[model samples]
Target: MNSHPLFSLVAGLLSTLLMVSCAGSKSYPPLATVPEVNVQRYAGHWYEQFRLPNSFQKDGASAEAQYTLLPDQSLRVVNTETRADGRQKTATGRATAVSGSSNARLRVKFEGLASLAPAAEEGNYWILQLAPDYSAALVGTPDRNYLWLLSRQANLPDSTRQKYADEARRLGFNTTRLLYRPR
Candidate 1:
């Protein structure tokens, strides 16, 4: 019988790859959000202090988000960013508060082709941490793949940034993965 060594090697590699993938996928406890969110008080302009790397927001020097309360109680989300080339990019979206979540969870849908990605469609926009004064916030997805630190002020204090990093770490996020624009 003629045995092909290449076939066995390929099968072994595939097995190893599958095992590694399965072992690397770690499932955590259900992501928790603050008890409640006052969408009315949350409405206003916010500066993106830090975020996990994502494809759509690449090349941004600075980013800001504005929220307007709609008549239907949904939120009008307008995100504007200054790219490294000095041009500005803006996107508009709608955020409908998830029912019975005390206005905490929101299903956000950004308009345009960017919405086509199934990976981005899973809307958790979970508010993991919110400042009592609403001055700073830590937002992340349940899957732990996305995270953002925001502040109402353009320049957030160093202490708050540290708090964000600590909280994110405690929440099963790798703080080292967070990206921030230099102020």
Candidate 2:
């Protein structure tokens, strides 16, 4: 079957990402998240400073996430990104904090084909590092495959960027693979 070039590229990247994550799992020690996260302070707009490459976010720039605390305590997540085609894509999702995790872990589900599968309901969002004033955060998965460095602003200073990279490296993620978006 002859698939479109873009589709093939996306499929290949997705496959490679999953295979690498599984193959690299044994090399890292158990992933550890912060002891607690005050969702109240953590809520609001967060700019994506950098992230480990993933198929779902290909050709996207200026990615950002907005987390709103719902009355029911579940969070309404809105993610916006400018695409390579000069279009903006915004996805809204729901996130529920894992019980007994002190809000450090979240199960995020967006409205898409993936949500139809039961396995996609599992928790994937882990808060690894958060600044005292909630100015910055390092979030990743337990497998150390997916990682994102988030900030309250789009441009992080050189020193702060290094600090975030150092933290991700220390947490077992391969910092060299980080992909930064357009400023």
Candidate 3:
């Protein structure tokens, strides 16, 4: 039995593991001039144009997320989706804007159901980009794991979509990970 072959196999395995680990690591570019996003102007109904798939939301379906300012400096998030079976599902969560910096950063927790334990780390949700007219928004997490393209109405114009995609790319988000939901 030659020891050289065994050593080469071990080296290859280690290199593969290292590469995989590095590829899986998460990093996000610094916020690009945190915009002065008015929470009041942002509050209302937004339709999901694209999103990273979550177990809660199904594919090829229309969904709406309603945001309302709560009394305690937090947001009331109500997400409703029309499923393929023609049934509707809704999830409610609370989002608290991180203090300072014009409320561009927020923490969202969906552990409202009594049966589930609260999340250990409040999910970092950031509004990366927003149309000056408040017609569209690009949102993502600090770790760059979750990103969503949302519009004020059920459909967004092609120009708006392209603009958001370019902005997301500029912000170093993985545009390939963006999953467009059917209108």
Candidate 4:
């Protein structure tokens, strides 16, 4: 009755579970105290300028995310990316607003199979900031490890970039770690 195989199996299972838990716990700090965001105006296409490296986005990739309101109180999320090799990847997901707010914060899950789960961990997304005119946005995690700068248009205005950076800094984000990707 050798115990080595059983011990190895248990260890592997624990490792896998730990990895999944870590991936699921990704979170960002609430947006720096700011005026309430007009979600209707904020809904639309946004081009990604910079983002913290995630398994979903490639370096030097050009990406866009479209948000649309749903009749059932959910958001239609469509994310498309053009990779460096000219390959396109698209992911569709549903985002539901977290309860008790104006629906500014949401959790988005790309895996459609888990769509029915009451609260799935895979689609944990939050909107960190938005420009008054809906021209730009800053998204990130509570731990400040992940951040994304997005613009309504393909190109972001210099003034808007500076303003977003300043706001990010005030929020205790490490602006230096931001990777400004070229579209």
TM-score of each: 0.82, 0.82, 0.76, 0.72
Stretches > 4 Å off in candidate 4: 1-35, 112-123
Instruction: Pick the lDDT winner.
Output: 2
Candidate 2 lDDT over residue span 1-183, tens digit each: 685888667767876887776884547777788899988888899999899998778745669899999987888999988777778888888889888888988988888875642222236899999999899999998777799989998888878988989988987899898887676
- List per-prediction Cα lDDT, in the order shown: 0.82, 0.83, 0.74, 0.70
Model 4, residue 40: C-alpha shift (Å): 2.6
Clashes (N, CA, C under 3 Å) per candidate: 0, 0, 0, 6
Model 3 over residues 1-183: C-alpha lDDT tens digits?
Answer: 354776667767865875676576665545653566778888899998888766666766678899998878688988898877789988888887776657788877774462242221323678888878988888886555578888988878777787888888777777876667665
lDDT value, candidate 3, whole model: 0.74
lDDT of predicted model 4:
0.70
Model 2 spans with C-alpha error above 4 angstroms = 1-26, 117-122
Off by over 4 Å in 1: 1-23, 118-122
Ranked by TM-score, top first: 2, 1, 3, 4
TM-score of 2: 0.82
lDDT of 2 at 11: 63
Which of 1 and 3 is ahead in TM-score? Answer: 1
In order of lDDT, best first, we have 2, 1, 3, 4
lDDT per residue for candidate 4 within 59-86, as digits (tens), equals 7788899988777868788999988898
